[model samples]
Target: MLATYPIAATEQNWISATLLGALRISLETLQEGNAPPEFDEALSEEYREDFLRGPKFKKAYDLFIAKCRPLTVDQRAQVLTALNEQNNFPGVFTSTTPCCSIKDAFPDVHSAANELFKHAFEKLSEWKTPGCEQTIRAKYHQLVDAHLSHGSCPFCGYEPLEAADPDLVDPDLDHYLAVSIYPFAGVNLRNLTVMGDKCNRSYKGAQDILLDEHSARVDCFDPYGAEQVKLSLEGTRILSGPGEGPAWVIHFDPDIKSRNWRRVFKLETRLRANVLERHYKKWIEHFVSYAQRHGFDITSTDGAIDAVARFKETCEFDSYPAIGRLKTCFFELVEAALNDPMTVDRMRNFLVESA
Candidate 1:
């Protein structure tokens, strides 16, 4: 991921309090062998009437009752304990050394719990703030605008992130730890983030980040607090094999976190198709144009090398057009290649021919 955005404290607090309050009340009522209350009285006194009367709330309550009521007394106690632990979501999330697995956390809990949590997320729009009158979803985007003003998807750093407005389309809210497989984290603000459509639906759909296909535990970047991951093309080389174009032999770091991130998002394939292959020629052309505009003698080898180095220095990782890191690395590779007189002559010839 390219960046991290702040969670809206007001929205997070309101939704979590209301939902957790309702769930606790319903579970406690069921523990006493009674059917949970309908709507107004289901949640705590502080949050009952304002946010829990809607159809979405009713549906979520119904799902919980159907799933949890049938559990044995001991089972209900275990689930309640899990929910209590989940209340400390921030600690559980940040202290996760490698990653958290739902199976390990709730080993003996009923699988139906997953469905209940899923239902709550699906109806997230129903839980409105008390006086603000905006759904949690709507308020989240307003927070996004404030924090993530870069206007690019943090996941891929290539696509434009749409502004969330009532009149405009909202960006896709991705559950970083996918809600379907991970229970009790579906509604946590720390677990949710706005991702590009391609990264969310196309590449990372339902894929478990905690465990690989072989079920081995792996570390992944925390979407909320991860450092900006760097990409480098220093050791990458062009292959001499026959194909549509020069086949890139890209080498990535062997660290577990980097490997897991690359595998989960298919980053190599995407970086090649979306950034390297699609933009290399244009980048070179732009370099030549920049050199000409800056009064560089591109026909000379030393001047061409200087132009490449200066252009590379201008690339910023979080710049407007996106893919700045990759562009910088690509130019570094170009600058290195310029050390070869043959490559320099090719660049000079291309500059003249294109002119």
Candidate 2:
């Protein structure tokens, strides 16, 4: 299984901000133009009322979707031209359009369109699914046995398969969520990730150790709410929160941490020495070599990126040095792309600098 990265909120920071501003401005403009100041009323009733489903509203929404949805690439260009002329969405035939103007023509279609846009935005917001330990364990072994007949870890980069087919992979245990959880506007494809046995089995039978709404009051770091997620060179420790302000610390797995530490440094000590020292060394060399390509001076970054990569390789959760920042960055960049699509280049540049 080949892993695809998440569409992060960090990627969309600027674009979301801009769209929010534009949305407010548009609403304000509409209100100012109203003879009796209907902006507040409209805003208040937007959720409760199905204005777009009204006869006139539905007509406009239907017209808009029919013209815009079935439009060929060339037709889409023309729709854009007309929308640009009115400073509103393309093909909004109604004068008092709700939320998105495109929905003003076909009110019934409005809800579906709104749902589509909402799902797309939420997907880009760094949403994650709970990792399943049992599923991961079974799948991890199957994947390893299939690709590594010699019972060796593929961390050495000499494995037969570099990726996996998501369709065949079992979701209950071996399935990853990010790459397929959200759908893009154009096509639908799922990215299943192939990981080593040790990494996938880090948590083993304890996969539900993450913070949730019920656990939020007791746990300081919320994986979703925090601004930063700090992980160690090994997959054992995690510091979560914003900036340098970490609020909580937790031990994911001491055994995994010890194994990962030894694996990372290729230490001569006795951690897994008899079981797979040679294999471990090969994997270590592969990653150490990979890190050098990114200008992440292994000696200078204080093994920062090394730690991050190792965490990713080991435990799927509580692994990732400065994970919160990376997640924030990724989410923001993705969000910006969804909102504007024009800022993708700038967001990419930002990622290069931040990394």
Model 1 global lDDT (CA atoms, 0 to 1): 0.68
Best by TM-score: 1
Candidate 1 lDDT over residue span 138-257, tens digit each = 887788767777788876767777886788878888877666666666677777788888888898888876667687766566666646565677666532233434456455544556
The deviation in Å at residue 119 for candidate 1 is 5.0
TM for every model, in the order presented, reads 0.80, 0.18
Write one digit per residue (lDDT tens) for candidate 2, span 41-68: 3222422132332344334323334434
